[model samples]
Target: MKKVTVTALSVVIGVGLLAGCTTKNESSDPAAAGNASNGTKPKVVTITVRENTWGARKDNFIEAQKRLNEDLKAKNVQVNIDWWPGIDDDELVLQATAGKVADVFMNSSVDIGWERDGGLIRDIDWVKDSSVFKGVPDSYTNIMKYDGHYYGVIQDMDASPVFISRKALTGLGWTGEQIDGLKDRVDKGDFIFSDLVNLADDAKKKKLVKMGFAVEDKRFEGWNYAFGFYNYDADQNKMVLSPKVKDVYAFWSDSVKRGVISEGIGDIDTDKAAPMFVKGEIFAEFARTEFYQMMREANGMKDDIEGYNKWFKDNVVWIPVPSAEKGGKPASYSNPAMIFVGSKVDDEKMPYVQQLIEHVMDPDLQINHTIASGKLPVTPAAQEDARFKAMDFYKDHAYLVSFTRTRPAHPDYATFVQGFTLGVDAILTKGKSSEEAYELFKKEVKQNVPADHVIIQ
Candidate 1:
């Protein structure tokens, strides 16, 4: 049997594509197996990656990919992402399961479940040198583990999610007093989905703001935060994953019907939504921390940018969806995107992979990228990275790591995800009640799907 050890009881997130997962043992060519035959190390290796959320078309990610490619080329290795554009998470899951393409897939959550069915392109579970992970904290590994083996490495290590809303609040004539009132209501647990439903409709009719909430519609943030509605059933020891997941669907559907939540959001992709929010029509949104910088860049030529800054002078607030009910901290789940090595590559290159991991692992690298991307650092040490140190959002949102989560740790998590989505559709589009959605969710899970365990690595 391969040697394995529980280094410590690391914190885990109970949400998204990366809940609890497992990976096959890592084999080092000429090292773990004691082969060491090649006098010269393998100079070329191809790595698979997911394009950044904005995709490589964005200058920042494109530049990083360029740098990585150049770095690898200098050493005789070539790294390329099995670039999949215009693809969503569900599609990625299907692709991974079919083993159709991608030797390494990073930036996917559903891939965790596929690992149970022998879907992984490579397994780095047996990585032994602690030095490779030195200075890197336990939190960053959330996306890399499958049953305690490191399978994926992160390309960009941002962990913070930011607040997004529009400058419309400024035009609404609501001074700071009105803003504080809303937050006070939110804090008092007086705000409920029903209430938000009303707010959305009222906003549309009264023009309080455009779209009371910027529905992310994307599975990662907007869709997932909806789960926080009923996510706090701690007796069950896990956040609920059924469609009945905390009235998320019903709330949105009703809000949509009432003209509060935009039906267009259902079709809105990140490409469209980000710009929509930045246009200052959205009341509030869930964003990565870089939103302000994006705003600053937008302001480069006009005083309206100053107006935009004033509107959010203290207003762009970050709020996690309430847990299980309307108040208290909700059981939030989080999963940062990740980088996975390719199975097609031989073990001889594992050392090189480790080197890359180390290079990105530097405190400076982690902090700079975190700031560049407006994300939280995964490492506890990186938490204090100058980026966070300098930002009030960081100091104020101290609860982010302390309270949020990742997907569950299980091989059959994909089925749960599928079922969860079904529940969401039923709730939002089908007018299903919470009870009804939960029943449909449970039925989907109980049906003949993959068991909740992955036997293959």
Candidate 2:
């Protein structure tokens, strides 16, 4: 057996994943197991994975690991998944540089392309033809690739839905039935994007909420898709700075000018947005499904689905971000958690790594994990699971999957996001005009991203 050298961590947008197991009973121990019925010793290997979410908390991944070991034992081999402590993104990059990343780890989808380019992760391009990928959505898988090769296996996908406050709407003279049917209206294209702002403005005017809509000032990746702006054209192999981007900037600036949104919104972080919702300062805000779960935890209902559901019964509802007009297209942003293997794994250990991938991608395991962790599933089977469908935020998020878009997994994606965000920040925080912001956007992208890779129309 080859020595294991890589030690790593898994980080997902402030949310957690799988846990570790510590029991060393011989029945489950790879080293203790041998052919008791015969006289032969079976080959055994241990795989290391980083523990995710809520430091030191036990999670469903332990159950999945147990199942994998049982299955491997049948093949005359035994496996043990040893879990390591988690680390932040900067540390991950540093560790990757030192070739000390864990044998298995996971990170945000947008980071994989660069990780692949830096040769920090292995390219499992064969997943394109593997049965293990069956039922996983392309929106989840596509963002795990870089330069047309798969470097990560999707753990889960999340869509940003516009969360509306029932209490605020009721304050604006909306009837109970109307509030109940709003999601269906948005689904059927009866409620357009403009309708969202219009209603928010009305709510503010009525003194029902201090602000009508809310968003993070410095991070605009999710909102870019929410407004139907795609910054890159993969087929053309160029970044697109269309007129639509300026339109989006103009819309936000106009909203701030109209006093329906907070001027300080541009200064807040994503974690701060939810509290504005809870405090009734905002009538609606674009948020990922995990935001709802965080709310549940905050309200002292963590892990108690019944209490969580009751707490949100009439408190809030998620709706698709409005279409441009009736029957127009709907949009949302999706980001998936991607599991990766360190590139330094030796040939003898590669097959076990492959087995670990297959185990992680299993639809049932994936579905159960998401249900426990308050995330959406990546596969059709997992999406349809009764447990997952039972979550309060499931219907709207699942319905919007057809319209969700993912960030391009370009090697320079982090740089592109920074450039795109700075442009938006200039308008929202720096008080720059839309024209000024547009110019800044063009300059930033052109100066940082390869010229041939960007097209500023």
How well does each candidate superpose onto the true structure, as a TM-score?
0.62, 0.86
Model 2 lDDT tens row, 67-118? 6666766566777666676766655565555445677787777666566656
Give lDDT per model, in order: 0.49, 0.69
Candidate number with greatest TM-score: 2
lDDT of 1 by residue, 248-270 (tens): 65565556566665535556544
Clashes of 2: 4
For each of the candidates, the C-alpha root-mean-square deviation to the true structure, in angstroms, is 10.7, 6.1
Give the residue spans of candidate 1 off by over 4 A: 1-105, 125-139, 157-202, 220-246, 253-257, 287-315, 324-327, 344-348, 391-399, 407-419, 426-430, 446-448, 451-457
